[model samples]
Target: MSIPDTASMPMFLRAEDFSFSDEFSDLVEFSFLPGRDDMVPWVEYSGGLPPKSLWGDSICGENTITIQSDMYDFLDMGALSFVPSDETLLKILETAEHNRKCPLDDRITLGDDIPEFNTELCEYTLTIARSITETIFTRDPYTGIVQEHSPPYPDIPRFKLTANPWMVSTHAYGAAFCHRIHLPLVQRVGASIESGTLPTVFKPVFKPASFRRNNVPTLTCGTSGSDVA
Candidate 1:
């Protein structure tokens, strides 16, 4: 059976009003997964792995590291600390002294003086600071004017929704129908039948000469009948 083009058809039926069986609901959910290929589960790995330190212990081969779960609980209110190494601590002190002498809004400007700070850590810290500044200040860089950060409106695709809600919801039901329903039905029917050929009821009508044109070329006799052209 042929299905009508849902895109060309008007949406007389709203999805909310439609009733579906539990089995159909399960199938719809299964179909939805394939459509959303981009979606990944939040928890990728089942096992928990302990964090490793940047510098490996050269002398004792064993360095005991303990992490209190509460300290790094970002999801909830918790206190975090920066326990720097002896080397990093010295660099931090130097940077603090420099800041006290000549304070700068941008941490990146202090990079020349603080050579001990790792490139990766410096970039990461600067990036975070810049992002925070942009959010808090919300200023026009060219004009040097501070603007209020306006609340962002919901970015819904109005045109696509208005054009075809059904197509958008089902990711075009034709693909889902063929994969989930029609192909499976054909396979089942094929398996049941003893004969290799499909049943007459399932066969489509064939017209061998359907494409032949009615117009045909005819030979015209010359004015002089004696000469056969």
Candidate 2:
């Protein structure tokens, strides 16, 4: 079945809008539908399924399939850009700070005498923020075409420490990253259909996959309002 016109266009594009190599194209197919023992040709040809770090497990059902992936993974794969929002960065920072002070007895701790602010963590945060905000990506949601805006993000502060962690509950990095992976899959599936290679038994139906993020409340116990002493 043909994809609907509205959803036909891909939602991701390469940096400078360049084309992906034939090898990469082949990799994408194998990457798709991972862990399907029934279809092992692609995996067998490619020296086994890719590591979980690069690709996520495939979620399959009677009618639909969902693939999960990390933003950095795609970026490593030559994705033009993958920057988590300022909010996500802040939350990550907050969680890191909170967890540093409140380490679980079971899990390993960085050290007993943690500094007021972790120098390495702070430096890492700044580096990631710079990488993301350095290039403002104004992406077309439907076409996946990315237009680079100079001067980066002007309004949103690169990073901010929220006094009240409770005020922040929502996380968007997963959803954003989900789209990053979704667009490519859509593009490839569409190509398969056009090439008359898509399985005849399967019907083409695309649905908006749901992405979930864990809040600090779930990860740590006790009051997140103040540091544990």
Candidate 2: tens digits of C-alpha lDDT, residues 121-157: 2211111223343444433323554455444344322
How well does each candidate superpose onto the true structure, as a TM-score? Answer: 0.17, 0.23
Best by lDDT: 2
Clashing pairs for model 2 are 11-144
lDDT of 1 by residue, 1-229 (tens): 8755556743221111111111112111111112112110100000000111101110110111112222112101111111222343344334333333432232222123344343222210000111122221222212223334312312211110111111111222222233342323222222222123222332323335433322211111111111000
Q: lDDT score of model 2?
A: 0.26
| Runs in model 2 lying further than 4 Å from the true structure | 1-24, 28-81, 105-229
- Deviation from native of the Cα of residue 91 in model 1, angstroms: 1.7
